[model samples]
Target: MDDLRRIDLNLLLALHALLTEKHVTRAALRLHKSQPAVSHSLAQLREHFNDPLLVRKSGKLELTARGNALLQPLSEALGKLNTLLGTAPFDPLQERRRFRLALSDYAARLVLPDLMRYVRVHAPGFDFAISQASRDAMLAQLADGELDLALGIFPELPQDIQVQTLFEEDFICLADKTAVPDQSGLTLAQWLERPHVMVALRPDANDEIERALAAMGLQRRITVALPHWSAAVELLPDTDLVLTIARRAVGPLRAFRQLRQFPPPLQLPKLAYQQAWHIRKDMDPALTWLRQVMADCCTTGMPSG
Candidate 1:
């Protein structure tokens, strides 16, 4: 084991190449080393292992007993080590890399459209895919490398995960224009009494807006409870009542003349939605670029809801 440390790492590469090719010239070509260099490496490896690793028989190289036993495990270890070292670093525009983001429907409506616009204008070649993951699962995905980023209120993030709050927004009540009396407004008490659409993206805590209603000795008569804002929006036109949602979620709904936004009745603490990623990926260049792009988009590009 002590002598093993003295062996050159490159010789192990040469040995793996030789075993795979079974010919000196072919191994040299594969390794981009001259045949004589490969021969020299073979000699050195034979001396280190104290066995002729290969022998010529029937006009082809045949592995001796030690060589045959080493072939499978050696090949496997070298393949894994090579893959670990050979993982190409990510480059944004030049590389056609795909990033998967885990976000709730509301976040997609609030953030992604503008982020996509930015990507289209700047990093046109980059690809993105989005999937719905509950807060707990999203954090897990980020840690596991299945998700590149998560933009939402992650109150339960693990201590090892890194989170950066991009912006803060408050909740707002949205209703069809015609639903309100005089197309003007309704009191906070009146708003709570009416049927409402609810979003339960955070399974553990009741949304702050709901708590505000409860403090007033009132509770929303929830007509719908959905996981995504997009789903909530789809229900708006069909239902004749108010929808409780984050202010940022209304950015993409400007085209809907039927929906009118009203400030929440009682003051609710602003929702601090953040971008979170695993600390392991913090220094990864491609991921760093992605974080910067998203942070910029959150700060400047989109209109605040």
Candidate 2:
């Protein structure tokens, strides 16, 4: 008990990093310490535990049985400690941090440009890496601490995750000005007859549109499907096809294309986008500031197009 009390707390943090990464270099990177310093800490940890916490295997580091045994309890304890300490009183302007984000295409368009601008003005050294995967995949990454936050039409998040509604958006029709010929709203008959292009980020993404049209005993003729939003946009300029996209997405596309926007002929359900994080990060001061940045950016840039 006395020896436990005397052990430095930072050593525990290094141990947690080492267990998580199973590599000295990555653990050092995570702890923001030099590799040699982390190596020394690892040696101390070995002495304290009296076991080879990590072992070389096939030219890569692997956690030993003892290290694997320590991972879960250590992670839980550190998470509690982090929540209690509140992340060293975060100062965004002075810190060099990298935030990994998982964003839907709509959120990226509505929030990212403005977010980047704000970062340049206030937190120059802060950087962001964005992933455009489906919300479920991103949320999984968030739960594992591989992603800092995910924002989009996320659903069915785990109970230990927390979410905040960022904004609500409605769908709008997009088409090339020349191909569409008529800038006025598409009639129900015309909308049903025109070939539709789809952005297939999720399998049921068009369900809302389909349900709305089904109410009128009408069906859309979706002739082409693209996996990417950019590809969907590229298709519009030449084909006599239209795509219904979230309101937040259209504004940013205007700088690139002269696309015409119209209200969807069908009454589509509103989309609520949310930002989600693991409960473990709920008290992180830096993450709190970033969520606020996202909120502020969304408020200012809510789809004039």
Candidate 3:
């Protein structure tokens, strides 16, 4: 630890620059120092590590075996340091990064399209993997770095997990146009009588609908239990079923004329969709950009109606 503490931060910066540029002159230019100064720094780095971090081959500088192994890890460490120092500038248009995202199918449907379109045009080469996992599993994934971000209605997480509310929406009733003659408003009694598609995707997810009903000594006849909202909308066209869905789902689900939406008369709590990340990544430039893009997707073009 003493040896680690004695090392100069500037020297490590020079090493990082040298490893990245592979040329003493270019590294010096990157560091805004003279070539001789950078050469002196490299000499000190070799003495400190007791290895030739870079060697010249065919008249061009190349990394030695030890240096080659350090490239990836060194880059990652410096990135985190940059984030910590708050000196990293996020250039989404030029950054090539693939982030892992965990989201419900409904959020994927509502958020991904707009998010992709924004980055697809504004920031080229950005890639994402959208996945679905339970909140506990996803929190574990975030803690372990297997996932970069998660979006949905997650419970209160540990301190290590950071959450940002993207938007809040209320539950609306979806029914086949033909199944309900009155499409304007659905009363509590009407909702109780209809056979419903119970969207119990997870133990905690959307269970509020049932809880609200139970509070008033009522329960809808559950006709089907599916893991995703996509199926519930599909069932509405052919079945006499009512689906209490998030307001955001109304836009895409509205595409199916067979399904029409009505505001349910239950005083259910508003559903808040959020983005979660490990607290460690709160300042990461790329992750911050991704979060902003997601927030924009949730808010744009959905005025009060």
TM-score of each predicted structure versus truth: 0.62, 0.64, 0.66
The TM-score that candidate 3 achieves is 0.66
Q: For model 1, what is the error of residue 275's alpha carbon versus the real structure, in angstroms, after optimal superposition?
A: 0.7
Best of the candidates, TM-score: 3
Error of 2 at 222 (Å): 2.0
Model 1 C-alpha lDDT versus the unseen true structure = 0.75
Backbone clash count, each prediction separately: 1, 0, 0
Give the TM-score ranking, best first: 3, 2, 1
Q: Write the per-residue lDDT of candidate 1 for residues 1-305, one digit (tens) a residue.
A: 78568999899889877765567887788689999999999999899899999999999787788887876787667657756987775655676678888877767766788888777766788898889877778887875557888887876766447888988988777787778644446777787678877777553347777677677776667777767676676677746768877777766666777777777666788888899986445445677787887887778874332
Q: Can you write out model 3's per-residue Cα lDDT over 67-152, one digit (the tens) per residue?
A: 87776677687777776887747677788988899988878888877777678887787888888887788888886668999887
Ranking by lDDT: 3, 2, 1
Q: Judging by lDDT, tell me the better candidate of 1 and 3.
A: 3
For candidate 1, report its TM-score: 0.62
Model 3 lDDT-worst window of ten: 296-305
Alpha carbon lDDT at 10, candidate 2? 93
